[model samples]
Target: MIKVLIVDDDFPVRMFLNKIIDWNKHGYELVGEAIDGREALEKIEKFKPHIVITDISMPSMNGIELIKNIREKKYGCKTIVLSCYDDFAYVKEALKHGANEYCLKNQLNDKILLKTLKETKNLIEKERVENGQYESMKDLANKCLKTLRQQFFREIINGSWKEKKDIREKIKELKLGDDLKNKIIMILEIDGFHKLKFGPHMRNRQILYNSIMNISKEILNDFNDGYVYRVTDKQFLILYSVHGEKSQLNMYKGMKEFAVRVQKNIQIYLNINMSIGISEPIYSLDRIDEYFNQCKMSLKSKFYMGDHKIILYKDIVKEISTDPIKISNREEKELIFYLRNCQYEKINYYIDLYVTGFKERNVKIEYVHNFFRRIILIINKVADEYDINPKDIYGEDTNPFRVIENMETIFDLIIWIKRNIEIVTGKLRPNDQNKFEHEVICEVIRYINCNYMKDITLVKVAEHVHMNMSYLSHLFKQQTKNNFVDYLKDVRIEKAKELMETHNKKISEIAELVGIRDRRYFSKLFKEKVGKSPAQYKKTIG
Candidate 1:
């Protein structure tokens, strides 16, 4: 079949082009459509169309430029420009750039289009024969057919083809099946696929994806009653026929068995884990989108059910309840108090209680998600109160919300939360209180040393350390045997003495360098501490 691509910015124009011709009936396949020349180039690379039907003007790139790029890159495709009477200049330019034909948009008809396509087809055939590339071209066309097949199923699952007749015609044209009404949909998803895509372990994402696809195809081929389509980077959709099953229950059992085999094979061969979501049998072809959604919803149960398991839509309905997880005001206070005091034992108790409640009530998955997010936020709120960054407890790169969203199971969440809680409370536990206070004092001194040349104040320092000003003042005096102001004054005086000894400068300059704005105040303070005025001290040092 001759492959054709349509590129136009106007939605109605593209739609008209798409529907005006019975492409498959007339030795052509409408491989894909794009709204602009840039996207058209991408489709050309992927679909490798033999001819391009494009508007003369487009956003990002125009038809003339697109044709130039095709020729420059040796894509060897013929172009037909769609233009209006006012676009004569653009049409002339496009033809000069090797556009095979020009069609006036207002006068476009199927007969005219068919004639243009035939001429384009002849040009393509002549080129292929002269270049002796028939076998290679044949291979590329077959690959395009496979891509078209996947696109066909993806569109149906996404509800892109809303009309039943269009779907039926495409399915038959693709030779997928004559009857798909009695089918089951299963979504097989790779666990932690994002990690693998970006993770150091699987550096080549395409290779990993292709290997998974091959494994899926090999396994499904053994069953001989199912077909698989790549849904996303991490997911594959399986459409299985229940033709031989005597009952729905039998079909479900067969699905479970198939899923287990797939998981085992992937784990053994690729060293990767997978999860499956199985939907109930569909008796109508029109509800493929609804059934596909059922599979996706079932897959979400894996957030609590863990990975490497098959979740049945029927099973989830039996297991879940609609109740929202709740916390009373008193309960909230209790949690806050425990967090403030670093009472880890109590925190553990609460964690266990929440997990137990979730399991016993069989709470909805969304409620669980909400509960997890709320708990993390509460933890963050407490951390902020202590001037502690949550990143220090978790890793700097960790995003609590994203972690919660992607966590595979309740157990995974519990482990992460408990581990972070231990870190937070361990730093503030009473047994380590003296050490923690000493560290705080050291940090405060370092802060003073660094900022003594600025407007240093107890309030600013306290805020920097995330401590109460009074408490920080008391602790500073107790630990260093000097109050906050005395320590800050001493640091400035020492800096001033160093400057006076090292560089020849005025007393005012020296005072200002040490963050003392008034030279008289600096002299008085220096006399009291160093037993000499600024000029007298500088003379003695000289």
Candidate 2:
């Protein structure tokens, strides 16, 4: 099928273009709909459509820039410009930039659109047949194309080819196309990738890299113009034309879904974790490097924001309250009480409450760092007063005092403090071995109860408890008289039952919120465990 991309700033215009023709019947596939030229550029590269129908005037990357960018990428596709009668000047400019034809918007009709599409199809088919003549040197041509593509991505994204002539020459030589403008640039870094001491079975870096790319492509298949390119050994840049989300809120929600899918797939398939820093949608091909830098700045949020999150540049708003975050004496004394008594859960609650309060206000980063640093210092003070060496708990090299000084986020600080608390608690009060083991099992159950809605697994829980997988499993089974998996499922099933009884959500949504993505599997499991299907249980409760 002849691939076709529709680019227009007006939502209605884009829709009109889509409905103007029965594209499939005319040997065309509607690959994507982009709001502006910049987004159109990204779509062009991704879909590599035979024809691009674009509006002459649009925000961010306008039609003129789009045509120029398409030419620079050496994308040999017909560009049909949608223009107003008064936009004849822009229409002429678009043609000069390599737009193939102009369609007056006021005079737009199916006949005009179909004729252009048919002609573009014929041109693309002829070119394809002509290019087929190079079969004798296919391998040589493929090798050259691959090398060119690598060099171009490296040069363009890195800001080395800023000159128009140089960029144009490279695009022609490489036969590459770019439909990227003011698109959201996502910088994804595999957490602890370089630090990973992989065994022999995972030695092939290319295989691992390809696996990552495959996962990204599959998850982002809906993004027709999304381009995932390797930026660094540990990082990838995803230039995705942000569309379909509808509103700013939905855009963020979309990015979140994108991040979740990538993170979930990576953890499941590669046994690896990754963090993504997403920039606010940007325009201008020349500004890619700048946007990448913004993404880097966003990643810095991880230092304080924690990992496995999609940090949006826009959300990094700095509306700092003039008044500093000061903990009252009462609050300090309460925290001290929890720390002294080794009430780990209570400590976590206070920390979360404080963090949530500050975050809701959208305090400055410095204030967040100061807050966590002070909290850690307080912990250190406790250790000193009790004649306890924190080094004993958090290894000799990782002095919590020293780490907190450099730590960025409250989340990281909480992790450090909780881990040390566990170590110190076990040591300071190990006389009650039975009680300590019971506490460990209880913590495991608490964690499951809290995080069962997330993609939690035995391995994740084991890590959270800081115990060997086997050891955690044994303890869980001993304490609960049920396997860890069974306990987790029971918690989820119970929660699902509660939600069903309340009749607050659809059964499918309840299944998803309770961690099961497959509604059928959830139904079957619920019936097997509770002696009734979810629907039956809900009806009985009602």
Give the TM-score of each candidate.
Answer: 0.52, 0.42
lDDT of each: 0.80, 0.74
Candidate 2 segments whose C-alpha is farther than 4 A from its true place: 1-179, 191-206, 217-222, 241-264, 271-275, 285-290, 293-350, 384-391, 399-415, 429-542
Model 1, poorest ten-residue lDDT window? 427-436
Error of 2 at 502 (Å): 23
Question: Which regions in candidate 1 have their CA more than 4 angstroms from the true location?
Answer: 1-142, 152-182, 197-203, 245-253, 318-320, 433-542
TM-score of 1: 0.52
Residue 75, model 2: lDDT of 90
- Cα displacement (angstroms), candidate 1, residue 41, comes to 52
On residues 1-542, what C-alpha lDDT tens digit does candidate 1 reach at each position?
99899999999998898889888999999999998888998999999999999998888998899999998998988999999999999999999988999899999999999998898898888877866787788889878877898787677656688777876677778775644667788888898775564545555777777777788778777775667778677888777777778876787777777788888988899978898898888877666566777887788777667777789888775567788787777887888899889797798788788888887777776788788787787778787888876766666788888887777677667756765676566545554335346877867765665456668789998898999999989998998888888878888898788667655556875787678899899999999989989899999999
Clashing residue pairs in candidate 1 are none
